[model samples]
Target chain A: MSDLASKSVTPGRDASASAATGYRPSRTLPIVAEIRRQASRRRTQLALGFMVLLPLIILVAFEFGGGNGDDDSNGGGAFSSLVDLATSGGLNFALFCLAVSAGFLLVVVFALFAGDTVASEASWGSLRYLLAIPVPRARLLAVKLVVALGYAFLALFLLAGTGLLVGTLRYGWHPLGSTIAAQIPPGQGVLRLLGILAYLAVILLVVAGLAFLLSVLTDAALGAVGGAVLLWILSSILDQITALGSIRNALPTHYSDAWMGLLSTPVQTEDLAKGAISAIIYAVIFWGVAFFRFTRKDITS
Target chain B: MYKRQLQIVVATSDQAFLTPAAPATYTVAIDGQLTLPTLVGTPIASPAAIYWYVLGALLAVVLLGLAVLLLVRRARRRRRVTAVNAELAETPLVVTGLRKAYKDGFVAVEEIGFTVERGQVVGLLGPNGAGKTTTLRVLMGLTTPTAGEIHVFGHRLVPGAQILSRVGALVEGPGFLPHLTGHQNLEAYWRATGRPWEDARFDEALEIAGLGSSVHRRTKNYSHGMRQRLAIAQAMLGLPELLVLDEPTDGLDPPQIAEMRRVLQRYATDGRAVLVSSHLLAEVEQTCTHAVVVNKGRIVASGPVGDIVGESPSVTIDVTDVPAATEILTGLGVRSVTPDGATGLIVDMNGTPRAELVASLVRAGVGVDRVVPRRRLEDAFLALVGDNSRGSGDR
Candidate 1:
């Protein structure tokens, strides 16, 4: 101990020699690393697990409950009609799953993944370390955003893919009985499912963007996810108010079901185009705010 | 023939050449060297000219905005460069007039100025809420300072600055992914740093941690002391030049604390620097080569450990019949007398000689068992921050 203390405070070495060798800020927090980190979390596993399980649960219910055998063509609108045709084929069941889950289930899942990405790190007290690692703030956010979106897209695919598999085994591989088309060929039906999946991925960007914004704004993971989901629900509620007239058209959820146009014979493009455009615009705005806020945030957490 | 290479530039001032009445093309010559088309295209009508004028104006506005943005960025970069170049010598860390005020106008660190030289373990000592942590936060770029500048390795520090790669820090507390194993957490952190795996000095850090096989166990089940040790090891990763740890010994047992003291001392060797903040005086006295004492966002005293400890002119006296010894010492007009232990009495020497006090004690029939100078950092710390110690506000 005395020998250690006897050493003078001026050990001879170059000042710059202590800088850690081979560090480049741009290379920090790569997208693959971020994906691996997030993927390892239990929440991510559970979310994707639930998505795969939901369709099986629905299939089991259909098998036991027998679909309420009232074949009188009740005309319960487009959604119920789609549900009625779910057992007809694998394609129809996949479409039914997409239609049912697109509104809320997919929204919540996407919001949870994107919202929890940053806020969870903050709550865990690791964000400051990342920032101090000198991971350029913009690169950090960009990588996390990419990974979150990737996971959200995976969740969508799992839901529809599981539904198709289960439905094919339970029923059979038959053409879809769409509302407008007399019978959609199995090949065309699968193509249309892919198209609908692409559209859902695009439309859900607004939820992901809003959740990402809230995640940057708050350290509480639940608050970020729940706040975004609540705001979406509020927009959905406000979209239901017909008395609001043309103003309701500006609502984020107004064109949420626009992918239904894909089920028509000629595949109506009008509402689908409007939905894609509006969703992109809203997503850009929310993402812009998130980037602007995050770059300047103090990150006290 | 224009001698100046017949520059056919579209001059905005030549309005007549662009008039609708003007011919589609015209030729001009100067000095008979060359002939060039003065008006190369059909003249634009008024409405078309207005449209072109609007487009030109929009393009000009965009160009001007881009130029302004570039200028601002250049100015910021220039300021940083100037700050870096102005340094006389490159120290591990140098902070000047650093101040930070929260959004609600509560000033956490009012004005702090200090330097951590290489090969020195400098301790930032203060009472609770005396702005020790706040100062460290600003230095780490975790919190922006409302005023002042921080320079590391002759580079002005900013959020996500590349110069931070040279420093390792564990500010406020340890932060780790609870779900990951200790080794995995350290690996993830180092990977996030984008530094080479070999530079992480994993074997050395893990040895310091002494977690043994527990390093492979998930962090969630680990105790607080385990996490603290892991965090300190994390900071030591890459063996950065400047290590800043806040309360590095908060959760350690006595043995671990003792080990930590040696680690910090050895780490600070070879031209590396360390800055640790702790309210524990003994920890700083034992570990740090130099100390900076802060009280209420201000430096009260700062110097080598011996100098600061020497400021308190006091002595601890071991005596039989402490009451009689105290009476003798007080009657001698020393500033104050306080009990140390059962047989120890601490007397503020007040510039009075130890021999004089002892002589009086013996004359009064009080057995003077022993007399030793009070050199504990605690005495110096209290002497420096004693008056307004309780007034140190919340951070």
Candidate 2:
């Protein structure tokens, strides 16, 4: 390799010579690798901590407030109210945890996961290098989106699962009481809990999509996540306006609390179902905007 | 229609409130007649609301499908790390009539064309904002070209083109996670490619970087030069077929710069090509075999370093009699002569050879201490581009 001309880059420049560079460089950025990269971030740790601590914090607050332990409150909110059903069994307690945090805390969590993934890469000046590495630009975004959604789901599960564990240990695994439409069977409680959490996860897609869109729009990670959270806050404020009529239903945040219907004795899934649908709609639109903008973006940052 | 009568109906998940055994049935009190919308079917049972939802869902699915198809097509085109391949045996990079115009209506590069042949260390020579970066960006498929074409190894360059796998570039500067060790950063990068660790050729790149044990230390703790070296090593990974480096010697000490010079020379061997961008004509002079000089978004001149420097010939003479030397050199049909300090005069010989200048100087009784031809690519560069130094930053 001493001579600049006579020798060249070595064994051989032909494809037959160096046969292995991992299938090809045109491959997508591996999802597993992206997940690994993001899983170790400080914000990720902080988000997980908030998820785990939220349940215990609520439980301790319930104990101190003496929560009227009148015991009848253990019944569901007749499947209509959005208050804590913590007095119910472990399952309802988890639902209570989700209900309290869904509007804001969970929105922030989803935004953090989705918002920071791509924008942070741009901020770090690594996006160009990633593309230079020949990670097809589209593939890079796709993998980042997948990893972001995965993290969002993981955060939701952690909060819900932790609530279940702590609630079960503190309260008993009793059936949902009469506050619900009727007393739900103890055996169906776990299934109901999982269903409610799943719906909550679906409702969060709006936040995820909005954050991901902002992530594409800006190079600042804080701006992307903060913007998404701020958007949700505004939507929540708008939901309070009865003057908006059914028009308000078009709001992505409109169905945020629809999951409460899942706890009804017989379960009224209409509101929750509408909310899930709305989330998907918003997620698809926002994600579409993101992909469109990203592909056309010059990527100077 | 003027005065709407309100009615309420209660229903649960399964049973309506009509069932006496039902413990609950939530009510939706409609002050008016209920309504539903339909998408395409007959407007039968409460179809108004359904219409809106169905429309929204359909809209989402269609857009999602479009986005997915575009992305899948891009991803499906397998990314090859072609830098390690020998596919471009003769032609490594080709930029034909390349032009780049920013969104601001500023045309950074205008129809610049050049080709980097294998085994040649080509230098992208320009002052700041000369469109050097923009040209390289077009070549590497970073910034899309407004017009013209780029073909790497005979394959047309597109965003994320598979042909790019054959290129290793350190554009802008080194961008690494501050908290991660140099080795970890490289590891993460290589792993992100999903390539086998054995093919990374990490040891060789590290050796070229001369990072030694510091590779194990976090990048935030490394010096600026160290980071730059790490970036070089990064670009060198897998021993790319075409290495495009921007200011490869920037931030490097003289010894490291010399070492870099050697590394680039050796790296350019074996049919591999290296395209280095730099504003320093001196550095490019020693480090590159050919030079492409750009000025104000246009290529001013380009050719072998020897030819470019020869194009702007000059002579420097150290003499005891500055007045006499200046007088004799000025009389020798030279382009210009400026007294250099007290004892030397710089002469732009233009085309006159050293023997004629020596003979003329001896004939004039001007004691010539030393008559040496100045080998300055800068002189050639400035001669070609003129002295327009504004608006360009080494950034």
Candidate 3:
């Protein structure tokens, strides 16, 4: 190799040919590689498998239990409460499913993706090698966050699809019921559902950002994941502590259920917008602190 | 004269083994210098807290026992021999006063200084927890040094696009996605670098790594040696100006270690520098032209391997009249002479070259058949690193 060519192949440049054309490689590839790595792991496969099979298990249980014809209190039947919840414009069954899944499984999924991302590399003694490639610390954290969010979105979408399909087939397509204190016409139900998905994406992004920040702070994969989960659980607990009052609104987890407004009659969007803004704010704060600390921290261990 | 003898003793293992009685100690007299043998004394005190102290002492003893066992095994498997040739060129990469401390106040590296020059493969020789890897990481810019600076090719190392571009490194164990094939791993690295995939270069790298047909196989299936070689190949790609390899031959067998030496030597011939850190002193002697011996996060000795190993004025004479030659050489005040059974004589001289000694023996009516120089970098490294009780001596 000539001196010129050797000089061009400097570390940290990502070695993309477009660099010669004044185009830098996107900082996203490393993040994608990490995601690909995690997805290939047996643990991730098992986790995803369990998630995909969850709704089916629920459907089977409800189907078998509802067959007894125990009660007919509402217009539908024993399962009618579920269907009414879906159509009653207040905490509909579908919206309730989104909130529950997002609050529970989505937190694990985000922690699974983000919290273990950098820590796993460190534990495997691969972080030094990756960093030796001269990758900037900031870029490294960015890639990690992107990968975590990618997994979070995929998990959320899978849960939503499974819940929607089973609920529609089992309870009939009567449109989504509301969870917030608003009403919506049937014509606007589809729009509201789309809006709810977008809002959930923001909420999950915040979760992923928190997990990623924790990953930077710890070398143990379990520590990062467990710490982030603990933080989320703690925040949820504190949010429910009535004495915390308005202070709960400041917790990022508080807005996780903001999509509840999408199911409300007349579509109460105020809370949803507040939730979206809060998610974005939390994401920025979490990611910014992670990047700053990671970039400045000395990786000795 | 004695310094010269020390060098020769270090140079030839054959002489050291043959004579077995040459004085192992030599003193140097320097003007205005205090020549004190500093023996650190422990405090004389009554043994208080007997149970806890006993437990601590027992733990220390057990740990020390394990360490000695490991060292003995390592030394037996790999006999370190340092070969210094004047034929090689010298250009140094200087690292000065490097230090790194974690947030919890654990110091990983402290005030370490060393220089590795051109045409020389230098090894950072130390045991685990010796901060060898941390120094390499800082050199590679993977970790920022809390203090001190590094100059590679006269360019001060600062985190930037330009500085990182010229350096290639493999720190710690090989880093590759397990599911990806060796080729795919390289491809991913290439793509991540934003470089257009070049099939020819990729193939060449795999070939150089000796992965050959197995390059298409998933890396998870690769043996430890193969993974290490692949890591080396990745560092060698794009012909980096300076290659910093950490435990490059860690898991390799004897044959693989030899192959690694050949590969690194090939890299050195390109006028590029290679800095390899390994606990295997013998391997370092074979591969590196320079050495920076570190223990406890600081460099004890850093220089051309030849200079550090110095020259030993010992000459081995393989001749039929071994007794006659030994007597003849000793008659001239060459007190360090020993007869080798029936065939050869070993003579240790003060600052005398092999040629001069052979001529002197021949002139004194002694037949001289063969004369050769000795190589001994291993002894020097052991002497520099010393026993484990030396607390942070290098730093």
Which candidate number would show the highest DockQ if scored against the true structure?
2
The true-versus-predicted C-alpha distance at residue B239 of model 2, in Å, is 1.2
RMSD of each: 18.4, 10.3, 32.1
Which model scores highest in TM-score? 1
Candidate 1 ranges with C-alpha deviation above 4 Å = A1-19, A67-75, B1-83, B86-89, B316-350, B362-372, B376-380, B383-395
TM-score of chain A of each: 0.92, 0.88, 0.78
Per-residue alpha-carbon lDDT of candidate 1 for residues A1-301, written as tens digits (9 for 90 to 100): 2232243333235454323467765689977789878977999999999989999988888888765776665567788788788888998898888888998999999999999999999998899888878786877888899899999999999999999998998879998786555677899889989999998998899999999999999999999999999999999999998999999888889989988888887666666666766777687688768877887878788
How accurate locally, in lDDT, is each candidate? 0.82, 0.78, 0.66
lDDT of 2: 0.78
Error of 1 at A23 (Å): 1.3
Where is the poorest 10-residue window by lDDT in model 1 chain A? A1-10
Between 1 and 2, whose lDDT is larger?
1
> In terms of TM-score, how similar is model 1 to the real structure?
0.82
**Model 1 agreement with the true structure over B1-395: per-residue lDDT tens digits:** 01223345644355766677755676644565655448655543434334335544654765686479558755764565444534524688888999988889888888999888878999999888889988888777777889998888877788767778888889878888889999999999987877777777787788878899999999989998999999999998777778999999989999999999998998888778999999877788889999998877988778887787654578889999988788788989999999877999888988898889998888889888888887756575556565454634454
Candidates sorted by lDDT, best first: 1, 2, 3
Deviation in Å, model 3, residue A181 alpha carbon:
7.9
DockQ of 2: 0.32
The candidate that achieves the highest lDDT relative to the unseen native structure: 1
